[model samples]
Target: MEALRAEHLDKRYGADETEVWALRDIGLVLRAGEIVALLGPSGAGKSTLIKVLGLVTRADHGDLWMNGERVLDDGAPVADVGELRRSHLGFVFQKANLIPFLSARQNVEIACEIGERFAPRARADELLDYLGVGHRGDALPNTLSGGEQQRVAIARALANAPSLILADEPTAALDKERGRAVMELFRRVAHEQGTAVRVVTHDHR
Candidate 1:
C-alpha cells in the first residue's frame, strides 16, 4: 500500500535578495513495509524534505497524500494536520529525546495515550518487549545505554502502530555498531510491521 506521496514540493526561505530555495520540485513516494534512507551531505535539504513529509513544516507548493487521502495542497493543509499526524505518523530524532523524569515504559505510554490507543500501559509494555527493551522498561533514559535508549525511543515511536515513521539522523549519536543495529531494527520494523520508514542520514553504509 502507498503510505505517503508528495509531488512538486517546494520550500523557500526569506524573500527577494536573501531568498533561498531549500527544496524545489521534490517528489517522493513511500510504500508500506519499506525502509528508505535519505542520504546527503549538510545543507542538502534532506532534513527539509523530512520536515515537509512529516508535516512539521509546510511546503511552499505541493500535493501530499497519506493512505490515499489528500492532506496537503499548494502549501495548505486540507485536513486536520494534528489529527492526521497523531493517527498515522511517528517520529524519531538524533537523540533519544525521552523525558528525563519518565521511565522507558512511561515514555512509550505517553505516546500511546496521545495516540488514543486502548490500554496504553499494556501497549507500551508490549512494544518495549517487541523492541527487546522490556527488561529496561522501568529504567530511566539517562541510566540506559545508548543503544538501549534508542530502542526505547523506537518502541515509543511504534506505540501508535503508525503507518509511516520519519527518523532524522536517528543513529547519529550512536557508536558504529549501535548505529548499524538501529538501522537494522528499522528494517525489521518496516518489514515485519508493514510500516513505511524514511531515515535521513549522512551514513552511506
Candidate 2:
C-alpha cells in the first residue's frame, strides 16, 4: 500500500518581489516497506521537502495522503494535526535530540508512553535491542558516542511503531562507517517492520 503521497506541493517565503520558493510543485510517493533516499546539495530544498512531509511546515499548495487517508488538501491540514503526527509519523533529525535528563531507555520510554499502546518499558527495551543499543539503555545521552546517540534516537522514533519514518540529515554527524550503518539500519527497519522510510541527505556516496 502507499504509505505517503504528496502532490503539487509548493512552499514559498518572502513577498512577491523577494519571494524565495523552497518547494515548487513537488510530488513524491512512498510505499510500505520501502526505503528511499533523497539526495541533493545545499539549498536544494531537501530539508524543505522533509519538513513538508513531516508536517512541520505547511506547503503553500498541495495534497497529502498518509496511509491512503487525506491529511492535507489545498494547503489545509486536518483538524488535529498533532494527533495525526504523533500517531502515524516518526521523525529523526541531523542531531540526536534526546532529553538531557533522560537515559537512553527513558528517552524511548516516553515516546511509547505518549503513544499509549504497549508497555513503555518493555517496548523501549525491545526497540533499543532492535536498534542494537540495548546495552546502552541505562546510559545517559552524554555518555553515548555520536553513533550510539543516533541509534538511541532511532529507537525513540520507533517507539510508537509508526507507519512512516522521515529522517533529515540523520547521519551528518557520524563518520562514514557509522553513517553507512545507520542507513542500513533504516533499510532493515523498513523491510523487517513494514515501515516506509525516507531519508534526506547530502552524502553523494
Q: Rate the local accuracy (lDDT) of all candidates.
A: 0.92, 0.92
Writing each residue's lDDT as its tens digit, candidate 1 over 87-203 gives: 899999999999999999999999999988657989988889988889999999999998999999999889899999999999999999999999999999999999999999998
List model 2 lDDT by residue over 1-205, tens digit each: 9999999999998888999999999988999999999999999999999888888998899999999999888889964678878998899998999999999999999999899977999999999999999999999999999999999999988889899999999999999999999999999999999999999999864
Worst ten in a row by lDDT for model 1: 112-121
In model 1, which runs have C-alpha deviations exceeding 4 angstroms? none
Clashing pairs in 2: none
Mind sharing the TM-score for model 2? 0.98
Residue runs of model 2 more than 4 Å from their true location after superposition: none
